[model samples]
Target chain A: MSQFSDPDATGPMAQGVAIFGEFVENAQGVTATVAVIGKKNEPLYLRLFDEYQTKELYFQSLVFVSLDVIDECVERKAMQQDMYLGFLCPIDEYQIYGYMTNSMIKFVVVLADVHRLQDFELRDFFQKVHAAYVEYLLNPFAPLDGDKIKSARFDAAIERHVATILERPPPAPGPGAKA
Target chain B: MSASANARLGEQIWQKMPKINAEFFTLTYGAMVVQLMRDLEDVQLVNEKLEKMGHSIGCRLIDEFLAKSGINNCNEFAETADVIAKVAFKMFLGVSVEVASWNDEKTSCSLLVYDNPLTDFVELPPNINLYYSNVLCGVIRGALEMVQLRVECYFVRDTLRGDDVNEIRLELKEHIKDEMAEEYRRE
Candidate 1:
């Protein structure tokens, strides 16, 4: 059981957070947190992957705090068909990004400020996460009423894909990489 | 009618039907099932409620099916079964079913559903007795009843339960005949 108040911590994310913090010190572009929010702005799934495992509450609160910015983005660009909402606000040492599906489900990812990612890389990450989320929704047992996601398969999928994205070598040191 | 004829008819009807996104349909059904599970709490009750709901839909669907397909009536049980497996299932679900395992009396048979839209992305947890697609049995029963063919329908095998394929066993119980008042009867 996680010391934090995550609705369900039996997923693989909890395990990764618990045992994988040793390498987080040198972790660049590491995903600090991932969240899935329902249409009613309820947290459907949340995971904290920060190096400091004790900061789960802080990272969780950061995800909830971005909901307002995501809503504003949605309202401002209601006519746009793009699902990626791009960079939201940055707090303390983490940068938050947001994405919303056609059905109004929201995904938010927080990354440590060690490295800033390219816009296209962020879009790709969001698209992949969206696909996983759609697949998760297809599970007949998954709750649709904003309850927390508790499937180990879904957790594993997210963790696996995020690992692949993070494993990419840093971009070539061109003029564009100076940012 | 031959099996090929039914298949062709099914294909024609499927092509003409107004279609929604497959993902949307799948997610909606998934969401409904989850909601049912939460509300009912009991797995058996949720299964029953889904079947009941399907029964209502099936009752209304038969009329539209007849009107759209322009099919009059099947003369024999074999023909009806073929139509259901090849035509009805194809047109509505966009998947084909195989009719197999007929009893000697011709009163019972099984429908082999290989690719079920309802069971896509579904992984049942261990030790749970929930029938995820039980509603399909009710739909077939209610639809056949509307055509005056009383039948008993149920799941014999489910892919969700680790079966190779989803099999629905359908048994003919009764064939309702025309019984009208003297004044209403045709001369």
Candidate 2:
């Protein structure tokens, strides 16, 4: 089994890190941390699921730190066309992925190392989150400014998406896998 | 126009208009009402504000209604009632209202709304006495006023208040004449 030893391999190599099929069996217990950042980089919504709930502050700081990388990625002309920024910088044992909407709102997800998720799966997750966010914004009570999202409905929607990701079936093994 | 014809027209217009998710619209309106209640701290004031806001929306929406429906005029108050219940309601809200209870003078009637999108996900607290869909009345009043019809509209019954159906009572006060032209002729 290949280990993600080099944290600096944040280019295409890091995005392709999901190729490690060996970790598929142990993926059920993987925890995820989700964050929403406003245009001014203010934290709008942050949620940590399962085991990561205890380390709330740690994940909060990590999500804030990932904003710089997201900003740099967004500034690049080539990456502007695609909302999904792929695998962002890795911090400690978790990997960060970023997605930005047309209105400049940013969504970050941090996943524990044991799980394996394909690029398309991550994109799907972000798309669902985006749909929920749009619905939340449609509420006239939800201010357009940098106010933190405090709606119970919004929280429930995000939690449902996170649950789906956690319960997703692992990717099928490739032809080169050792049986 | 026949009721069926108006229904068909409303359906056609509804198809042509750009649409958003119904749930989103419902939630947005619900949240707005809740926010108004919190800020105003008076159920009556919130109801008035909602009506006022709907009045502005109606003033603008009438132009759209005229443009899209290609309706030049309604010759009688009865015809106007039919158009409002069958066409206008369906065109904007995706639901058709039942126009009933016309008095002998035919100047007053009630529009029965069986399915109100605004109150789809809403359940009012027992302590709160509010007209959640009062904006619909304002919209009708404002729209009719633009067409030179002086009408009084108000919620007679609300499904939120355990009524069998939502009823908006409409009473025509007068048919406004061309006051500006009359003044000019007098001068």
Candidate 3:
């Protein structure tokens, strides 16, 4: 029924495969997702908010957008945290949102209410969220769940992933077996 | 205050006003005070010293206010008190006050605590004189009273209660014409 399940679809394809993976990895009620947004805020890639309903994180509502969108949004709205490289925009129905961008991608992080967080707490929290964003980017098969990765660890994982990507050298031949 | 874009002195004063970056200053100062109170054994003497320090700081801040606002003079003691609470608090701590009672002779003001850095995780040890943030109240009282107004100020509640929000209540007693007489007696 879904295009994801089409038999004729070329290359790697699986239905409920991502879901099954999610059930195992996110046992602590934490999940991270990614998405590609098209024109008019239309999400083109996988969405996290739509799929997982049970698991919960402190930062329940966060979205990641491209760097260009971040620049555009900054013109209209204030940036939530100066320490984190992100812009902020207000959505009437959604309350508040954080728009993050690096050279690679754009991120929109929506929240129920951020006024509770002080300036320092807000900055630290955003830094963590930025780290999580990078981790989600590195995982090739990690289902881009749009807004699913709300946990602080998810953000920490992003930091670790980023440090690895930036620090690690190319893989060398193991055991001298292959030429 | 010069409105020109290249007004260096105006810009420097603006930045030093504390309100421009009050959050960082408040957080840092509050943390230092908290650590000091925890580490030191003498809470009473420390409190008095802190209050004395606040008194001097308040006096200087008044000069800054006059320079920036360019106000000729305060008409009455109540008006002077108003400027002291409003402009000084806004510039230094990023807070404002509500005047509970004001008369021709005396004035009473209340500083409704919103989010103060000094009051964070602050517990009042049984004795009244052991309060660390009493410095802030002393600043208000000492600054205004120096100009001839009597001030009775204290905390409404212990901030460490963790149940209720904090409030610092200030009661300006009465106006005295000859402040020098009272100052001499105290001296």
Q: C-alpha displacement of A164 in model 1, angstroms?
A: 4.3
Off by over 4 Å in 3: A1-179, B1-23, B72-78, B101-106, B117-132, B158-160, B174-187
Q: Write the per-residue lDDT of candidate 3 for residues B1-187, one digit (tens) a residue.
A: 1123113433444467645454455456555565666566476766766777777776665566667755445666556545544555555555554444444445555556555656532334333355656778777767666566667777775454332445667675776599568899998
TM-score of each: 0.63, 0.56, 0.40
Candidate 3, residue A149: the lDDT equals: 33
CAPRI verdict on model 1? Answer: acceptable
DockQ of candidate 2 (2 decimals) = 0.08
Candidate 2, B71-183: lDDT as tens digits: 77888998899899988999999998999999999999999999998886455655567999888988998898899998998999987666779999999999989789899
Model 3 chain A lDDT-worst window of ten: A170-179
Error of 1 at B128 (Å): 4.5
lDDT of 1 by residue, B1-187 (tens): 7999999999999999988888778768877887888798999998888888878888989998888888878888888999999999999999999999999999899999999988777767657888888888888888998998999888889987768899999999999775764548766
Worst 10 residues of 1 chain A by lDDT: A170-179
Misplaced by over 4 Å in model 2 are: A1-30, A75-79, A168-179, B1-6, B12-43, B49-83, B91-94, B98-133, B141-187
Candidate 3 accuracy as lDDT: 0.47
> How much native contact recovery, as a fraction, does model 3 achieve?
0.00
Best by TM-score: 1
